[model samples]
Every structure is written in structure tokens, then in C-alpha cells.
Target: LSKQTKDPRKKVRMLALAHFFEGKSRYQIAEYLKVSRTSVNKWVKDYLDYGLEGLEELPRSGRPCKLDDAQLKQLKAYVLDSIDRTEGGRLTLEDIQQYISESFHIEYELSAVHRLLKRQNFSWISSRSI
Candidate 1:
């Protein structure tokens, strides 16, 4: 299940692996599973290569990670715990994100801040009414 898995394709491969391990031949698995034999073989190979998680497709390509979680949490704490909190109370998303940009020594774009906060279940409200 995607809820329990970080990799969806791995879930599929896990199912296939289960069936094959249960003594089903690849052709039977393929026919019953409505997948090409090659697909079944590939998933099985990937399963063997790196276990189930490896069956999930990786990001096609990327530069690489430049930061780590401790750094990110430190930045979030700075933004959430240190920024303006008064009768006005609490940094707005933009303010917090801007603070993150300045304080983290990283240049995060506005959209990136929105995405990150959204991932964190944080949201924005109108400052004047906020």
C-alpha cells in the first residue's frame, strides 16, 4: 500500500514476487497479472538487485541532495520559533520563508517555500486578519 510504502512500484513488485515465490511460473504470473513477461522479469530482477524498494522508479535524474534533515529542522525551528511572534503573533509563510532564505545560507525560491510548508501541513493566512 502507498500509505505504508514510500515506493509504489515496489508494492507492485512485492505482489509479483509473492506470487512467483508461491510457485507460480513467470508466464502464469504474467498472464494472470496482465503484464508482459519482460515486465515481470524486470521487476523480479530489480527485486533481487536491491530488494523491494529498488523496484520503485527513482527520480529520473537529479543534481543531488545538498542539505540534510537536521539542517532543515534547524531552519524550520528558526522560522517557526524565532520569527516575529507578538500580539500580531507568528510569522506568515512568506516572512518565515524569507527568514529561512536569509538564515539558512540557502537561496530558496518563494514557490519552494510554499511547497515545503505545504508538505509540512503549514498554511498561510492574510497577515492583516491573521
Candidate 2:
């Protein structure tokens, strides 16, 4: 089960339990797993308290996106259209940043703009000018 799991953290938890069941000490498991003894102890405790379900990751609430789906779609269209509208058929991050600020009335850091474009499937190479 540990070897098959794609999630590295879960794999560690499963392996820790497996090692414990095999009569390995928590210190031994920690050294073998390259994890802290505290972490190994916690994993063992969680398993004893809640079974296999305790090893699973809990859902986390991350920061929400500034733009919703519809707004993102509109932004993508506008970016595509900018190439046709520009003199050299080139669109830069500054141009997109300005457009986003003017059209959406929302200010985003240049890095955040880059991340947003990436999330929308716009590659860095494609979004750049010659």
C-alpha cells in the first residue's frame, strides 16, 4: 500500500505503520524513513486512535483566486485579442498587467499575473514578445 500510493506523505505514514507492525522501534522507523521520531510516534498514535483513515490527508482551505471562471475566460479572450490589436503582434506581461488593471479594476503583482496566466494554460514562452 505504501509503495503504490502516489502521495509521498501518505506513503510515509503507511510505511511507518508497517514498520511498527513488523516490531520495528519508532526510532528505527524514524531513521529508516528519514523522518523525525516525533512524527513516527504521532503516526503510530493516529493509526491506533483512528485506523487507516488517520493517515489520509485532510483537505486544506487555500487562498481563493481573485478572478472567477467567467472573468478568467474573458481575460483569456482579451489577451488573445491583444496580439491582433498590437502593432507587432506581440503581447508583454506589462501590457497584460495594464489590461488586467484597467479591465478588471484589480491590481495584481507581476508574479501573480504570471501564475494566473500559467493556471489558464498560457505558457511563459507563448505570452512573451520576440
Candidate 3:
């Protein structure tokens, strides 16, 4: 059953169940599993309350991205096309930042802009040759 489950947490739960059935104390089980006593208690409670389904991880909530997928695709296409038509075919970080502000109406920090570009597989190359 543990092998079938892909989540490591579920595997841990299975181990906890095994130890629980063996009549081990919650503290002993926690020590064996290298987890906190509180975690073991919660897992046992969850198993009793919801069975196997309760052991699954809950979905997490996080901050939403300022730019949507369509907007990102459009931005990539626009920047690449603009670079093709420019003199040296290179864009500075500030230039990209300004373009994002004007086109998407979203302001990002210089570091954030660099991270976004890197995530999109865009890199900086100096146009001037040494």
C-alpha cells in the first residue's frame, strides 16, 4: 500500500499505522519515525476521522501571479520581435522593465524582472564586442 502511494507523507502515515497496530506508544512511534509527537497524534486522529483519504496532502494557497499565461506569451513574442528589429538586437534590464510597465501596467523590482526573464528562458548578452 505504501509503495502504491506517491506522497512521502502518506508513506509515513502507513509506517505510523504499522507502529500503531504493533501497540507502540505515540512518543515511541514519533521517535521511530523521526517526527514530532504532535504530528503522530494528528496523523492518528486523521486516520480515525477520515481513513486513508485524510492522509492526503491538502492543496496550498499562495499569491497569484500578476501576469497571466496569455500575457506572458504575448510579452515573450513582443520582446523577441522587438529585439530582431533593433540595431544590436539586445535589450537592457531597465528597458524590459519599462516595457512591462507600459504594456502590462505592472511594476516589478529590478531583481524580480531578472528572475522573470530567467524563468522565461531569456538571458542578457552584451551587444558590444571586446
Candidate 4:
């Protein structure tokens, strides 16, 4: 199961518990797994407290996205539709940033705009140019 699992962290947790079941000490498990003893302890504690579900990653509460799903879809559609309207049929980061600020009333820096584009699978490299 650990080998088949995609999440590397979860795989480590499973291996730690496997070592625990084998009657290995926390120190032995930590050394074998190459993870900190504290991490091994936490994993064991979480497993004991909540069973298999605890082995899964908890939802992280990070900074919320400026554009929600619908808005993001709208932005993507606008970008695709506006391609022909752009200069040289290419949309620059500045163009996207300006559109987001004017249309969505949310100003994003160029770096943030680049990240957004990357998340949306919009590559800077043009297919035709490739």
C-alpha cells in the first residue's frame, strides 16, 4: 500500500506504523524511516487517536484564492477569447493583470498573475512557436 500510494508523506506514516506493529522502538522506527522521532510519535499518536483517517493529510487553511471557481473559469474563457484581439495574437502578463484588475476589481502583481496562469495550465510558450 505504501509503494502504491501517491502521497510520499502518507507512505512514510504507513511505514512508521508498520514498524510500530513489528515491536520496534520509536527511535528504531525514526532511524529506519529517516524521519524525526517527534514525527514518528505524532503519527503513532494520530493513528491511535483517529485510526486510518488520521494518517491522511489534514486540510490546510492557507490564504484564500482571490478568484473563486466561477471567476477563474471566466478569466480563462476571457483569455482564450481575447487571444485574437491581443497585439500579435499574444497576451502578455501585463494584459492579464490589467484585465483582472479592471474586470474583477482585484489587482494582482505580475508574479501572482504568472502563478495564476500556471495553475490554469496556460503556458507562456506558444504551441505554434514550438
- Cα deviation at 13, candidate 3, in Å, is 1.6
Q: lDDT of all predictions, in order shown? A: 0.71, 0.86, 0.85, 0.88
Instruction: Kindly list the per-residue Cα lDDT of model 3 for residues 10-99, writing each as its tens digit.
Output: 899889988998999999999999999999999889999999888888877975667899988988997788677745646778888898
Q: Candidate 2: which pairs clash?
A: none
Displacement of the residue 93 alpha carbon in candidate 2, Å? 6.8
Give lDDT tens digits, candidate 1, residues 15-116.
Answer: 788898999998988888788999999888877888756677776785443346876677667756644555566566577667766776676667777777
How do the residues 1-130 of candidate 2 rate in per-residue lDDT, one tens digit apiece?
7556889899889988989999999999999999999999989999999998888888889878888888899999987787666566567788788988898898888999999999888887654445
State how far residue 56 of model 3 sits from its true place (Å): 0.7
TM-score of each: 0.48, 0.58, 0.54, 0.65
Task: Estimate candidate 1's alpha-carbon lDDT, on a 0 to 1 scale.
Answer: 0.71
Give the TM-score (vs. native) of candidate 4.
0.65
**Top model by lDDT, which number?**
4
Model 2 regions more than 4 Å off: 2-4, 69-103, 110-130
Q: Look at candidate 1 and give me any clashing residue pairs.
A: none
Candidate 3 Cα lDDT to native: 0.85
Candidate 1 residue 30 Cα shift, in angstroms, is 8.8
Candidate ranking (lDDT, best to worst): 4, 2, 3, 1
